[model samples]
Target: MTNIQVLDNPTMHNLLINLSKEESFTFREIIEHTLESFSVNGERQYQPPPSIVNRPNGQNTLFRPFTSDTCIGTKITVESGPDGQGRKSPPHGVIVLTDSKGNPTGLLSSNEITGYRTSMNAFRFLGERMWIIL
Candidate 1:
């Protein structure tokens, strides 16, 4: 099945709809884990303060004009899988986070969001079939 066909079919469309939801939830989880894993110690902490407040020379004014937040952006790609014609296809993508300077902070190529979405869709479908709606 081709990616274009996957986007065209109604069943696939529904699956994709749920897949997107799952991917979003999974991506949030991944970000939470990453944030939990991060630490600020010694130079790392002082290197870039979470927020910077500065006062202009000759002006008795304090201002916090710089702040930063972090998140992981996920993107998916499909390359003619194994058979070359996409008779059987697979997905490839990665997750990356940008630093305050807009540079890549980490490279996570697990395709975890895709796998989570696929598995959740199939599991839900099967559970419905088995009347185990949990």
Candidate 2:
């Protein structure tokens, strides 16, 4: 992942915006000067598979995984917007299960993953402070 990737999604951007609002720091600033540095954008390029596997004058088989369980994997979640918000619209965020190569083997909303990551970071920060006190 790269800075380019983090700033790409609106939800993640919104989350970062919220973080900036609460933490009083820009997302870019945090990414540039943070204890836990991570690439925002991670990409997996497509590779065409061998033709012989198809048989009978087999053409090139592109093993590109798109947005589906058959291509990617199962979508575990699908919700209509955030709670306390009106209007039934497309869900926000997506949970994607990736393979060992980081290719998206599955897709879901980012809600749970985002929450867990944020919470764990918070816990780690507080825990470290508590340890210092003790």
RMSD (Å) of each candidate, 1 decimal: 18.1, 16.5
Candidate 2 RMSD to the real structure: 16.5
Pull out the clashing pairs in model 1.
none
How high is each candidate's TM-score? 0.31, 0.32
Could you give candidate 2's per-residue lDDT for residues 103-130 as a string of tens digits? 6444434554455456556766686799
Of candidate 2, the 10-residue stretch with the lowest lDDT total is 41-50
- Which portions of model 1 show Cα errors greater than 4 Å? 1-68, 72-74, 81-86, 117-134
**lDDT for 64 (candidate 1):** 15
In candidate 2, how many Å is residue 2 off? Answer: 29
What are the lDDT scores of the predictions, listed in order? 0.43, 0.41
lDDT of 1: 0.43
- Score candidate 2 by lDDT: 0.41
